[model samples]
Target: MSEADYFKNMKHDRNDPNPFLAIFMDTSIPFDEEAKAIYLRDCSSKTRQFLLPLLRPLARLAIILLQIYKSVVPNALTSSKALHRVLYWGMKTFVSPSANHMILRHFYLGSEVLQFIRDNVPGVDVTMNPLKPTNLEPVKDDLFLIHDLNLYNFIINLNRELRDKGLEVKKRDRLNFGAITSTRIPIEPMPDRWTNFLDLTSAIEIFTPVYQMFLTDNDFWRATNSLQLDETVGLLASKIIGSNDRLALINNKHPMVPLTTLRAGFRLVLHGLATEQLHALLIELKHKQEHADLSWNRG
Candidate 1:
């Protein structure tokens, strides 16, 4: 089916026990084998296998340091323009053009997914007002900001709903990021055509380790179980571009989940280390390719 038609016909039942799972079971799309191959190679690389165990202690230490940093610089982790600027420069300088496109596309995709959940799921009235994507010129900083605000609002709103359901996802008492602004920034509609170098499942596999490291155990479980974001994203992805395993992996259990949360945490640390290595390699390859093109043009 065409992309536009897919979204038009997308349907979810509010009465379904798990709307995300139900949606995926009812839909099917073609798999991108090239993207799947890249994901599999990175996940199974010998370098990653060797370093997984070694990174556990370092990951623990890093988490402790992160807590210390958060205490010292309370606003550092909070959503702000300054943080966005740093991220913008980092992406422009180090990330490949294809990777940058994928990253930006993620913001748009995420916004749609969140909106879908809010509208279809009962009792999920998240106070999100994302800015329109009118122009991609200013390096799409506005789009990034909108995505961040949407995520922030979604979490805050979802937490409130969970509290009403008697499942408190314990958090810091002083963790308030203040009220969300009502003003909306204008943006253009998503382009009709864009390169798809990376699929959603691959992107999820790449970032799951980093997410596991950053989030506390309770918060992580609450996000996965209570919010069911994984299933929602998996469903959204499956409908657009099918996962190699189809909907088989789209469930309540996290792909990284192990015998215990503790073990899962350690395994994720290794995964993060491997991801870093892979990212560095990509950056280097990008630079080399650019240099080769420059030389050819000069000659």
Candidate 2:
């Protein structure tokens, strides 16, 4: 039931040292940090001005904090008192105390905390689990598993390595990823961000051959539908949550299937919760997950 046991079961044959990337696309480009900071702040202001007129004051704070977070997060992921105006903005806009509190809840704002850990904190482990509910009933054809991961951080250790030598360009990024354990940053390992950054910096292509990187329906569907899955998978998945994405290729009839299933899975391992708290959790999951959806270009 441990993560080590779970990852051990994977059918990994690749000698690819960097994360086994399924790069959707990779053209050589150049990109940096200071430039990143300025881009972040500009984008924040524009978002606030645009969202302000239509939203309540508290909602306005939600938009604004995200901006301040961008400005301050160039260094860490925790809230910055230096830019504490977000609080003032929220209270001013959301007059309903309950509504105002909801808008400023820490989890949404805790994105900064995550960033802080990534930059300043040291030695934190993150776990991800994939335990979304599927048809547990004996319906033969209706049985399909939609597994999503939960990330936990009890034991991952991180240590930074600089100017790593002897790395072929293709392998450089993976080494850095490997070194990420001893550090306290909680950034996810999803290919779109960190891996892409590495590829851009090292001039290595993600999913270079593109064809092999593509996930075949057979590859995903068969894996999902497997009834004999190791039960320890959920625990294993929890260790990798931030590093992986919750995905679905199910029939379009169930657009929200992934989140719904995750709701069920939460009940299985978690229990004895207050009704109000549980209710709130589900609501946030629904709202944030909608924001989490991705768009892809048809090839």
Candidate 3:
């Protein structure tokens, strides 16, 4: 058969009746392999000049606006350290600071709550610990956590979103998280599936007093009210789509990530509890996990 005819037949026979031939699907190249190849081909610096005309207007506008902003804003704002703080505050106040990543949001929230407990709750001594990746199956997921691009993409998208909403956002260099680390609370990772409940509780039992302190402290409530984190959680729940569904070939023997990913709903709510120590956080997680209704689906 001709090359074109072979490809046409391949498309049509994707659902071939013969099990042997259909099972060989594993050998086939990815559907987007050609598109990916084309994208990489056009990514060269020489090829990139082809789009100069398309970007000229945007580049000019950005340069003009930047000059105007720099001129009008106070000279104090020009300091790299001050500017970073301003940008970071804007991101936290207006946008979801965790890039709307469900799991990361939990870590962020947990750290904040722990810090609050340490600062305001008398007699409570909550220690901040680094959450290292676990030695679990599918090491790729752990590696994905270590990569910094996710954080960078979140910041870039945040700036884009703010600009779309009429804020004149200047393009800044890749943000350094270390600059803002002092402001962030640290949190340890939760127990993995392999960890027994008794062992898990033992590690986390220190948090019980912290959680109780949150319940009793009026200052804690005041702090949360000031941050308007409840609304932030609502906004995040509405914005981030949360589901744990996937498609797989029935005959495939080896599948990646045997379990569905943590649904956004659970992650967001869990973060709320971890960060805010709101009433009945655990209850909410349990209810949603059991029912997983449309409301929970929003996260």
Candidate 4:
């Protein structure tokens, strides 16, 4: 078949033999692969921090307007959207600072945590004495505990969920357990059949060298720079996703990690002193990433 026809056939899943997308699905982790697959599915259901950038300013604006109205006007304004904005702010205020992921209007139970915390962990004890500090030093002026009772309950629920899946903390695979160390809250494992996760993310170390070369590949880089196509290309490179899920994918955008990588979500990285060749290449990569990030799928 011709090259265009070959790529067209690859248009489906990573199961297709296009090396660009195949590596994502072919690799396996030491733990049960199905469990990894379930983890990916749950992660996808929750908005991912690394896939897309959030328009937090807009959310902030909605919240602020609602707050001001609540302060002076009191019960005058009662639109459902306004109620939502006010509720959203309260939820964000109570959420753990470590929650780097996007806070959606959905996720109703998130609000329940605050209520649980306040009901149990009040600012004062039975003697009516103020409690300990609000937050960590420098982060918040006061140290406050969000009522450990709720957190204890959350842990209970989380553990129970894992147990129901036939996974016990005592018997959990070391590989999957270790992955949780890298994240704040441990994400649930995939069931036994889904992900072919591998421990050697290091073997993927070849990625850095390969990315550097791609950074320097001006002609090839130029061909891949269009925002419209870059989305699809990034999805293909990452596996487990494709560009058709536009908004969902963009919200996966994570923070700029200091670690150097070939393609952190499809952006090439080059590491070398400022030689003209590499300097020009870095500039090109930055441009390509910025160009790729725009919502070209929209008008």
Best by TM-score: 1
Candidate 3 pairs with clashing backbones: none
For model 2, state the Cα shift of residue 197 in Å.
Answer: 41
Q: Which stretches of candidate 3 lie over 4 Å from their true place?
A: 1-105, 108-209, 212-216, 223-299
Give the runs in model 1 whose Cα sits over 4 Å from its true position: 1-63, 76-79, 118-148, 152-228, 231-299
lDDT at position 145, candidate 2: 17
RMSD per candidate (Å) reads: 18.5, 25.4, 25.0, 24.1
Q: Output the worst ten-in-a-row residue range by lDDT, candidate 1.
A: 173-182
Cα lDDT tens digits, model 2, 1-299, are 42223223445456852221111111111111221222223223422345433433433344344444444443343322322233233233322222222222212222222232233222333332222111112111111111211111211222111122321112111111121112222222222222122111011011111111122323222322221122122222223333212211112122223221112211211211111122222233334444445322322
Q: Which portions of model 2 show Cα errors greater than 4 Å?
A: 1-82, 92-95, 108-299
* Comparison by lDDT, 2 against 3, better one: 3
The lDDT values for all models are 0.40, 0.24, 0.29, 0.27
Q: Who is ahead in TM-score, 1 or 4?
A: 1
lDDT at residue 206 of model 1 (Cα atoms): 36
CA lDDT, candidate 2, residue 245: 28
Estimate the lDDT of model 3.
0.29
Candidate 4 residue lDDT tens string, 148-169 = 2233344445445545665422
Top of the candidates by lDDT: 1
